[model samples]
Target: MFVHPAALCESDQIGPRTRVWAFAHVLPGAVVGADCNICDHAFVESRVRLGDRVTVKNNVALFNGLTVGDDVFLGPNAVFTNDYNPRASVKKTEDDLLPTVIRDGATIGANATIVCGVTIGENAFIGAGTVVIRDVPPGAMVVGNPARHIGWMCACGRRLDADLACACGTHHGADPTTGGIVADDA
Candidate 1:
C-alpha cells in the first residue's frame, strides 16, 4: 500500500512494501528500493537512492549524491551532508555534490552526522551523537565528536566483550545459546 498525502512522490521507482508516511517528502528524482520504511518528517531529496530493506527513522534528511545501500538502518535524526564547503554567493551543481555512501548493513546511530565525501564501510557502526569526519573502515565501531575506531561491534549491534569479537562474532548468552550478528543493526 503506497500512501502519500500532502507529500511529493514524483519518482516512479519506489518499490513495494515501502511506506512513505505522512509529512515525509520524497522528491521526483529519488530512487527508493524495496521494503523500505520511510518515517515521518523525513526528507529525501532528488538524486538520493535508498537500497533494499533500508529503515529510515523519523526526522532524518538524506540529501543529494548520497547512496544508502541494502539493509542500512538510519536511526532517528541521522543526517548526511553532501558538501564540504559552501558560500552563499556560490551555487553548487550535481558535480559539486560530494559522494557519500553508507555501505550495506551499516547502522548509523541516532543523531550521527556524516560529512560529505566519505564512505562508511560495510557493516560499520556509528554511535549516537557522533560527528563522523572521515572514512570508517568495514566492521569498525566509532564514537565521539570526530568519530574514532574505539573497538569492534557484533553484527547484532552489541558492543563486543573482551573476546575481541567485533564485526560479526558469535556471543554466548546466559541461556548458553549462541547468538551472532547476521547483518548490521541486528
Candidate 2:
C-alpha cells in the first residue's frame, strides 16, 4: 500500500496496491482491501472493513460498524451515521452501534447521508444529497430526501428501462422474495 506522507495510516492491514491519499486518516484495526483508493481528507475508523477496489472519495468519514463490499464507490462528502440515538454524555460501546452494509458495486453519491443499520444492495445507486433512512434493494436507484426508489439500475451503472433491460445488454427481473431487481441468471 502507498500511504502519502501527509496521510496518517495507522493500520497495518491495508492491502496491496491501495493508496491512502493526503490528509486521510486510517486508524488501526481497519481492514482495507486491495486496489482501494482512499481519497484526501477521508477518515476511516478502526472497526470499518473495506473490500477490494473500493473508492472512498474526498471528505468522506467512514465510521465504525461500516462494511463496504468490493467495487463500491463512496462519493465525496457522503455521510454515514452509526448511532440511531446519539448523546454526547452517553458513551456507547461498539456493540451499541448499528452496522451499515454497502453491498458490492454500489455507488453512494456525493453529499448523501446514509442512516445506520441499512443495507444498500448490490449495484444500487444513491443519488447525490439524498437521505437514506431504510434499506435499498439491489439495482435500485434512489434519490431525494428519505430516499425514494425511483428506478432500477444495472450493475454496469446504467439505468434500466421499463422492461428492466439496459443498453449494456443486461436484463433484470424483480426478485419475488425481496422485491428487488436481480439479473436473470442470478
Candidate 3:
C-alpha cells in the first residue's frame, strides 16, 4: 500500500501491496486488489472493481460498472464508456449504465476505447488506439479503429503458432462451441 501523497485514494477496500501513484484518484467503494498499480493521473469510479496485480496506466479511468479481472493490463490513456446513448439532457441512473468486463490476463493497449456492454475475454490482446465495439474472444488479438481479430495470442503473451502452440511450450486451442480459446492444461 504505497499510496503517494499526491494520490487521492478514498476507498477503504484497497488490498495490501497496491501502489497508487501521483495524481491518481480512487473513489470510495472502488475495490483495488493487491500488487496493483494505479498509475499517475488515473481515475477510478466508485463501482469499478479491479482484481489482483492489475496494471492501470497513466491517464486511464475505470468508470462505474467496469470490472477488471486479475493480472489485466490497461495501457496508457485507455478509455471506457458506460453509456451507449449519452445525452446532456438526460440524467442517467446507475442501472442505466452499461457494464464492461475485462477478464483475467487481458491486455488493452494504449489509447484504446472500450465501449460498454462488452466482455473482453481472458488473455485477449487489444492493440494500440483500438476502438473496441464488440466482445473480444479469449486469446484473440485485435487492432485498428474498429478492432478486428488479427491473430491469436498465447496465455504467456506470445503470438500463437498455426498449431496453437506457444514458444513457451504451452498449448491452447479455440473452442468451437463457445468460440473462445482455452489452455489445454486448464
Top-lDDT structure, candidate number: 2
Per-residue lDDT of 128 in model 3 = 96
lDDT by residue for model 1 over 43-160, one digit each (tens)? 9988999999999999999999999999999999998899899888999888987989998889999999999898887778999989999988766789999998886566566777
Per-model root-mean-square deviation over C-alphas? 6.1, 0.7, 0.8
Off by over 4 Å in 1: 166-186
Where model 2 places Cα greater than 4 Å from the true spot, the runs are none
Query: Residue 18 of model 3: what lDDT?
Result: 97
Give each model's whole-structure lDDT.
Answer: 0.82, 0.97, 0.95
Q: Which has the better TM-score: candidate 1, or candidate 3?
A: 3
TM-score of each: 0.86, 0.98, 0.98
As for TM-score, the candidate ahead, 1 or 2, is 2
lDDT of 2 at 159: 94
Residue-wise lDDT of candidate 2 within 1-186, one digit each (tens)? 899999999999999999999999999999999999999999999999999999999999999999999999999999999999999999999999999999999999999999999999999999999999999988999999999989999999999999999998888998887678999977
Off by over 4 Å in 3: none
Which ten-residue region of model 2 has the weakest summed lDDT? 177-186
